[model samples]
Target: MKRRAFFLKAGLAGLVVGNQGLTSCAPGPKLYGDKNFYINKGYQAIPKLKLSKDRIIKETVGLRPFRESGPRVEKEMLNNKTIVHNYGHGGSGWSLSWGTGNQARNLVKTTDAKKVALLGCGTVGIATATLLQESGYDVTIYAKDVPPNVTSNLATGTWSPSSRVCAEEKATPEIKANWEDACRFSFRRMQMSLGLNDIIDWGDEYTVRKQKPSGSNISGGHEMFHIDGLNPEWKTLAQKDHPFKADYVRRRSNMIFNIPSYLNFHLNNFLIRGGKLVIKDIKSLEDIDALSEKVVVNCMGLGAKAIFNDEELYPISGQLSCLVPQTEINYKLATDGAYFITRKDGIYLGGSGIERSWDTTPNRQLTEKWVDVLSDLMKDMKG
Candidate 1:
């Protein structure tokens, strides 16, 4: 069949064909499934994604604060003040926030200081602050940006505790152990937030590929943690059982966050519990020394690079283009170079991973490329 005709048959490009093309064809009876009708008997038709320039809601870019040695969750003494370091989570900030917060809270609990100062109001900072408040410590958060403007808001909003968290060579025994604890704790904490104003929920994700993935292509880092059952079990689907135009499809369920709502919920919870937030930027070590609290938890993310002289900290730029929401499309799809996830806000399309790039400007070309990739994948879709 011709490419255009195939698209038209699949109900994907009738608008491009125009009214003239429709008028040219004589009216006939609509055909139903024939020989292969039984093949799709119980299968639900995958809803076609309305991919177009007009459907796009917005394009956003975020810089993941990557560290080669993984997240630094330890305490340091500086100028008579105890600075508990809890930053550089990279792409795993949201996924591992609760676990890391617990680690930071433990460090603070050991200190005699009853009042704690938190730097940066991003996910990590908020989580740490709330945890400390719950533990009976008076907490004050000082940050340059919050909520909609924070880098955490630009995340893809999926559970990926190890994504760019650390390099392969840096995943030592101690780091792996700490990572496992965080993953397990975060997974349990995330479960407690499910159904709370839809801030977090579980959804199936389909990883489609043109060919079967080889052993080397499969990631084994998650296994190294030894946190069994933390994530949903993966199941390989038969070609006829799935809807993607791919030779292999593996499906698994994972937790996803409605970032805006989640942040708001936590921020509100903190405020209700008497936690204070002050809008301020800590530019240098002098700024840190000016804080009244003797115990300070630094969750500055990438901003820690200059303030703390963390040469290991760098940014991994990622872009996401969101489209109008479709209520029926609840699952997530991940192809070779792009991924699409359905959320209450919009249908997020993402896949750009530019390392050590500090630029947060959305790339138009990259957005177009992702659209093209999704369009091509759905061309052969049945529905």
Candidate 2:
């Protein structure tokens, strides 16, 4: 009895010692060559990457700077070094990174500038900047706001971009071919990681379908649904197991992302590899043309309307109500013009499409409405 008691006491002492040193010894040296490596053996994902990786994804919010016409990714009105315009990605910036970034990157291969200047620091700008930096050019991001500060982070990103690309008239087959390349490329890039890149994820996408919804026919730059078609560029929703939102609720091959994870990973990657950022509200071309003499990557997003004077640019605002997270609600839904997504600590509930709702302010009325509607849906789920 005494021997067992002594051994138990010794084991308890060892466990206490191990735990006691955790705080002081945590965040230890690099392991197995991965810079942010650690030996956390049985560590479960506590809550969400948003809180755990706070240093990487500094902030969260949303904005709108899309173009009425498809993404303007070709050389625009410019001078000096070769400028590959890569902005106005609408809602699919992360979803179209490699695909679109490659298009812009292709325009500059023949004329490799010593340095590159990317205008915005949102997803579109960051992806463009990162690709350029990776290709051995000194890259600088000039923007009024940076990651966690920009609108890209504000969105509850899904893998669907309805009118993100403009109509057939605006985005010619040639430009669309470039756009397709951007899509496939971005998808491929996501394939490279082991799931730590939170800004993007591979999961089932469920948009509650009612009827074959028509996309925005008029070009006021507003879009609501991208939830049909077989073999969609990303993936299509499943029509087999339909939901009440429509006659069919299709399960598609798609993404459910935590934007914070995406921002922090790339932001850290950029900083680690020696990239520069300047926070400047560029009022004119003269300001940028005067600041850095590098070949500029015009990833201005919606800023091009004034700075680049492209009237095709417009706004499409999206709003979501955040509820406490429930893992059971792992899937996402789009029913009766509303969307419900289960992200980290919150279940994003929303669906508001006021044509001229350019305001980014949260709508309390809309929030209340969605909450009531969602509560009814929850009951329906039970019924």
Candidate 3:
């Protein structure tokens, strides 16, 4: 998940294919496409991906709990018990999972209670439980559904926090510090987590452009926020260095988590480590307080709209169409609205964010539209 939608808003141009030519291949950022020159090696992907209606193994939707004010990570008392909220990262849910989980765990520490209840078993819920358990607390996850079945599985699973996290003007200065902390912690965890068939790895990402997008970094309905440890500059890439048929190209190193495997790893780890999971559809906030754990952490994502009655939180509906996996397709390419990434599970082609659209049913027409856009971009490659 290169977060093209957010990058387009930030007007972030190329940075992946260094400042040198494709032939020299130095380590520094460079661009070289003034001539019609084309290098022939290390620049080819298995062209002509088979993205068809029949090839679509599964189509899932996730309603990003987007809030104009930013994610909820505060605590309040209800029914003589403490309930800590930790939801609403919008498209950055998977990316910010561990960091936000740590943030929630920090809140849990203020209370002397050692037993905690986690609501929702998606990325955030699971992460929160793992952290709490590691901190020597008795933890149980209460959710209507678990991973491989939750909305978290549908996430593109890219490490991009500023991807619709919040508007700069709307976010308080403290939220920015929190974002940095969460990002740094999560990045370190990803580096130390299971890798090489475990669904977490470093991958190359390309942000291809037809022309420089119109907007300053923070203007034009877009936002450009910086993370402390990550590189903000996108180096230019000549057309000869990359495969896409775009006028300008930028590249960067990105951390990627294959959703299906990543979720499975977390769930299995939590269970094997003595964490308990209870499958119960909570009917109300009072229902949570009735649970055995004294402290309840709400990680309900979009469900909070009804569960907690927070009107500011809304769904940013997103859908991803996946093709059969091609292991050689290791990198990702993102244009205006469409993006492509390949993982062990499948080659992913996506996506669209329709505000307030909660339809989980995959639209064949929308899928086809993205497929066509990606196909046309790759149609020029020789491989």
Top TM-score model: 1
Better of 1 and 2 by TM-score: 1
Candidate 1 residue-pair clash tally:
0
What TM-score would each prediction reach against the true structure?
0.87, 0.73, 0.84
Residue 324, model 2: lDDT of: 53
Give one digit per residue, the lDDT tens place, for model 2 in 1-383: 99999999999999999988985788975535322222123331112111111122112225556665667778753555556788776766667766687778777665746777788777777777788788888888888987666777777766554445554556666656666667667766766643674555555555444465566432122333332342333334353323233454445455666776777788778878999988888889788778664577787776777877777777767776676555644566555645666666466766764433567777666666765665554433311
Residue-level lDDT tens digits of model 1 in 227-261: 56768777998877886678888888877788899
Looking at model 1, the pairs that clash are: none
Q: Report how far off residue 238 is in candidate 3 (Å).
A: 2.5
> What is residue 190's positional error in candidate 2, in angstroms?
1.7
Q: For candidate 3, lDDT tens digit of each residue in 1-383? A: 57978787565444433433553665665555522233244544323455556777766676888987778899998877889999988877777788989999999999999888889999889888999999999998999998778988888887777677875578788888888888788777777785546678777777777776765651111333576446445668776676566777788777778888888888899999999999999978778767877789999998888979998898888888888786556777777768877777887777678787888888888778887887666665533
Give all candidates' CA lDDT scores. 0.85, 0.62, 0.77
- Model 3 reaches what TM-score against the true structure? 0.84
